[model samples]
Target: MIRPRRPERKAPPLLPPLKLYKAILRTHVHKLPIELRSLGDEYVKAEFKAHQNIDNPLHIVGFLTQWQDYLKNLDGGSWQEGKLSQEDLDKMSPEQVNQLYELMLETKRLGSEG
Candidate 1:
């Protein structure tokens, strides 16, 4: 009996984690509001550190894609928040929820300052 040939898999492109991390932090410094810049920097640092050892190509691509989109939005001054659904909130850890709250407060504070 003849066996069917398996499809060839293409490898995902390699992304330099440290370089991307620095680039994103720099973008945040320039694009984020004064009150948010530090918080955003910390968040990115923690996140990058957490994912520094990721070996899954698909996961790496997804992560890079999301951050790239975020950087683009920041560059364009189009960063905005949308309402999180109940399910979305349920999926977040308490710390994540608190961070969101802090982000909201930062935005309000910046608005008042300006």
Candidate 2:
């Protein structure tokens, strides 16, 4: 007898748009410098508004994942002109410190050229 194929798994339901919107803005934009904060808020609002009618689970997940990563980079200061604070450096292991140093050098090199 031939074995039956397993059904494909479905993605979990997405958080409601307003809920996700509030969370992202609260977590990602509230603390930014005034001018930049407003700009970021507007961009996020526009993007979310544009995607409001998206019904595909895959696309919604991808959009949420992309914004979550953006929030993480903003919170971690990884994209804050690629600069790490002395306090943050002091908390890292020697290996991490070395990695951060290398990353900073690479960012600085690219920053100068671009």
Candidate 3:
């Protein structure tokens, strides 16, 4: 017997990179606290700059997808309550994990200094 074919799921539309970057910086980042706004802006700028030359479609999609989720969370006022899921942590490379750890430490230090 032949198996029935299932329809492929479609991903929601994403903003183009420059548009998304501007949206994050111009709209979302302004809603953050002063210190956090500075940090968030710098981080977003650096990440976008770093990925500007990336040629892989999958990597670009994943990068944009994550940033888009962040934008959505900020818009919905749940960004502070966000936590990394185990599945997401499992997907990170060692370097990415280290970077996340460092960012955590920096945020903690900023919190302490405030």
Candidate 4:
């Protein structure tokens, strides 16, 4: 008996690795206006400064949510968004550097876990 052959099916691409995801999240946070990005991050840093053990993952997710809202609001404001160029990283304030580090660490942890 002759049987019909089926076409090969390929799986969808896997989501980006966690390192990339965290970097995106950190970048998103850094690019937000100080007013928009400050509250949650200040909370995280304050807790850290107090020597409290904070949930780093939750902090990252919370920041991600805030960043998304900022993106939504800046939906058409490219001019403001333009200021956060690659050049800006070198000039980032100490707090921004810390946030970036925290985000990258969380992302690396997520990537390793998966």
Better of 1 and 4 by TM-score: 1
Cα error, residue 84 of model 3, in Å, equals: 0.5
Instruction: Give the per-residue lDDT digits (tens) of candidate 1, residues 47-73.
Output: 888888999989788778767766667
Global lDDT for candidate 4? 0.53
What's the lDDT for candidate 3? 0.87
What TM-score, to 2 decimals, does candidate 3 have? 0.86
> What TM-score, over all chains together, does every model reach?
0.61, 0.51, 0.86, 0.29
Report how far off residue 69 is in candidate 4 (Å).
8.5
Better of 2 and 3 by TM-score: 3
Clashing pairs in 4: none
lDDT against the true structure, each candidate: 0.78, 0.70, 0.87, 0.53
Question: Which candidate leads in TM-score?
Answer: 3
**Whole-structure CA lDDT of model 2:** 0.70
Q: For model 3, where is the 10-residue window of minimal lDDT?
A: 27-36
Tell me how far the alpha carbon of residue 19 in candidate 4 is from the true structure, in angstroms, after superposition. Answer: 29
lDDT tens per residue, model 2, 1-114: 999999989755566667767876886555565545655677689889888899998988878876766666677766566455789678788976786577557546655655
Ranking, lDDT, top scorer first: 3, 1, 2, 4
Which prediction has more favorable lDDT, 3 or 4?
3
Which ranking of candidates, highest TM-score first?
3, 1, 2, 4
lDDT of 3 at 40: 82
